[model samples]
Target chain A: MKRVEFFVAVLILAVCAGALWLSRPVAAAEPPNTPRAASDSNDGALFTAFVPVLRHPRCMNCHSKGDYPRQGDDSHRHTMDIRRGPAGFGVTAAKCSTCHQDHNLGNVHLPPGAPAWHLPSPSMPMIWEGLTDAQLCQSLKDPKQNQGRNLDQLVEHLTEDKLVAWGWNPGPGRTPVPIPHDEFSAKVKVWQAAGAPCPSR
Target chain B: MIGFSVNGKRVDLDVDPSTPLLWVIREQLSLTGTKYGCGMAQCGACTVHINGEAVRSCVAPVSRAEGKSITTIEGLSPDLSHPLQRAWLEEDVPQCGYCQSGQLMSAAVLLREKPAPTDEDIDEAMTGNICRCGTYPRIRRAIHRAAEMVAKGGAR
Candidate 1:
């Protein structure tokens, strides 16, 4: 009876240990080419940090799939008959930069702008319309689909990309992303350096 | 502040009380189709049905619409399959489309009250809705088509 009880206790301890191990967060692997600047082991932490910015109105509106982009925090379709063109700039007659200047126009009911005031190119849309974080992470890593960018290129894109920086300064009447652009860029670098491992959905 | 039935659901909102019902409906309730154009109410971009009457929402205050049944574009139909919507699509009466929501809301009230509104009646009822797309002819045709559809029992 004493030996049986001891075995039962050992089995319970083993099960608890296994459960704890499974519950612990898995660290992301570092990519071979990941820049020294972006090295970090916390893949899950990186995704959690980016959730709000990825889902912000400013980012989601232009990253929409349909021809017409959404507007405002409500995510309604654009008022005008705006269409994304073959080049994804905008309709031929009404290019995106026509109303959206190099910087935000500071108008209440006009097109907001950024230095590169255009949609993602059709060839490599980098579509984020309805992507889950895991899907987005996987999609971002594909060089062919993500504008032929490697992990290093992606790090550079996030850190120095003009449009990505716009989330911090989305103009009047727009809500900015939760994190500062510099902080977000730093996180991206960290995630890339950690091997750009996708968090389990 | 006002109390009204929206899409058959009762709602009460506290606002400027004298502020235009349009602002209350949009800013407070987050129903955005009812637009703001020429806040003086000269343009019917903010048209909505108040107690079955087509009222210009931009000028009508919350106090005025109090205890009334107010219906905005979102309340028209869940999927936008209203007869007016079908007719508008058939006639393609949209350019910038900034004004179509108001136009449709106004037409909805008109059609509900007068199932077979005459051209003269339509002109009198719809004169307020200004289409910047120069779709006046198309608007007239769609209204008539909607009426015909209603007459044929095809309206949902």
Candidate 2:
């Protein structure tokens, strides 16, 4: 009887040990700390550097939701009944090229111009009006939302697009972006290099 | 010399190109119909048609209008018979009548584009032009009336 009791105790001990072994691996496979640590520290820092520049009026004015791109720092509705026609330029009689010249008017208060003097074509407005930092970061990373741009392509656009460069050289009576263009480009590079993380909130 | 066409007449002005078109229209040529409410482009009171499209003449430099065709409120019709003007009268669209010219100039553009514009379209096009007396309801009704006149093919 004593020997039988001893065997039963050993069997119970073996079952308990097996349960412990199976549960241990599951926690190891998805350690909760890993993502929290990565998002809170590394990616969060990268997103911190990106949100302000994207939110600046220079970017927000054109990246808005409506059919018409805003004008001026106040983001006032563009006068002249200008709508972001199919191609983001004005409609037939009111095309952007009607007045916006190839270069900034040296004279103050004239409509500032660029080679392709139009808003981001209505097709891909890339609205960033009121998004939280996290949402905007996520949207930027998504190819579907970022105009099919990968990180490298986005970097090229931010650094080389002439219209975007106009933010730095916005003509007279307007303030340029606060961060130097080069510095702004550099921040983008760092964020992209670090895998473009979105912030917690 | 800044040369341009106004109301089908070609004219050249020796004024500085930096001069606002409002000055050239109101002071130089004396087309006083294009009222100047704000020196800035905020008020659409100085609205005019540059190549048949509404533009705020107050902030638009004379140089930009140098070669363009400009149409002022006074040019819409010799005797105020343009469909929009006729509708304005029928609907009693003016209160103080200060902003009527600019409102008509903008409404004309809308009629040309969408002769049968819905209420939303009118709201979209006319929001920039402000009427101090708040004659928006009358203006909106007038726009609808104008659209009907044009669609009836008797607008002229």
Candidate 3:
């Protein structure tokens, strides 16, 4: 009976040690790229870093809900009465490509341009103009609203998509997104690493 | 060399792809009918047809025209007999005559898309072309007259 009790105690000690080892930081056990689960204390703050980027004129000009895109720092209606057309580009003679080119023109007040310059298609406007930070975060995470992007894709788009990158180098005279591109990209990665948490409000 | 057909003639040029198609058509191809009004494309004076679609050439890169067919005002008709041109003459549409080529080019596509364009269609289609001479009323009248000519098949 004494020997059996001793074996049972040893077994319990072994199990407790295993539990302690498993409770340590997951970084030691997982692959380098595996995203950590959301840390309750940090996720909210991580999402806050993205708010200014989402609201910048450079990002909102094309992401608003409307048949026409706004232009300039003033967010005025585009001159020449341009329409969003069947595609996001303007209709007929007033198409986006009619004026915009693959890159910015050398002069200020000239048409600021980039490749495939257009608004989100009418079917999927992805409007961000009036959304609260919480709502925007939820919308971004929702696959239906986010064009079916998973967290990895969301990170990739925020970090590397050319159109999104345009918010950084938006021509002469245009104010770029408030955050530096690399900083914004790092925040996005960190947020993704924290399971892409959203603010409560 | 970048190759494309302009007004039914195939030509190749060793120009930078970023050069505006307007300069290519004007300086290299020597097809000056497509006038340059606003180099920013705010005005439609540089309108031309790329693969039958009306395009503003002033802002369009030569790279965008690669392997495409370009139609200038000169190609509207070999003998200035396109319906829009005929209507413009009949209705007396030119004032300064500088904006007429671009206006005609834009109108041709409008008519092609809307065989019998209504007043609203005309307003929508021709809105991009600007005429500082205030010939809008006459331009509208000419588009209507051209639509009628098209309906009757009286002129090609």
**Sorted by lDDT, highest first, which candidate order results?**
3, 2, 1
Rank order (by TM-score, best first): 3, 2, 1
In candidate 1, position A99 carries an lDDT of 37
What are the per-residue Cα lDDT tens digits for candidate 3 across B64-86? 88999999999999998999999
As for model 3, its CA RMSD to the true structure in angstroms is: 7.1
By DockQ, is 2 or 3 better? 3
Q: Clashes in each model (backbone N, CA, C under 3 Å)?
A: 6, 0, 0
Assess chain B of each prediction and give its TM-score.
0.92, 0.98, 0.98
Q: Write candidate 2's Cα lDDT for B30-142 as tens digits.
A: 99988989665555788889888887787777887878899999899889899999999999888888888988988988889887988877876776778889999999999
> Over the stretch A1-201, how does candidate 1's per-residue lDDT look in tens digits?
999999999999999999987885333233334554322535466656666777788788878777666788888876554556567765422345333545554446544667767777777777777787878778878887678898888878766887878878887788888888756766676566656767676
Task: State the lDDT of candidate 1 residue by residue for B68-130, as single tens digits.
Answer: 788888888788688898899999888899988878877776677678877755665566567
- Stretches of candidate 3 above 4 Å error? A1-34, A38-43, B114-121, B148-156
Q: List the candidate 2 regions with Cα displacement exceeding 4 Å.
A: A1-51, A64-122, A129-156, A160-162, A169-175, A186-201
Looking at candidate 3 chain B, the ten consecutive residues that score lowest on lDDT are: B119-128
lDDT at B147 for candidate 1? 89
lDDT of 3 by residue, A110-200 (tens): 7887778888778777888788888999888887877789988978977898878888998888999898886787777767766788888
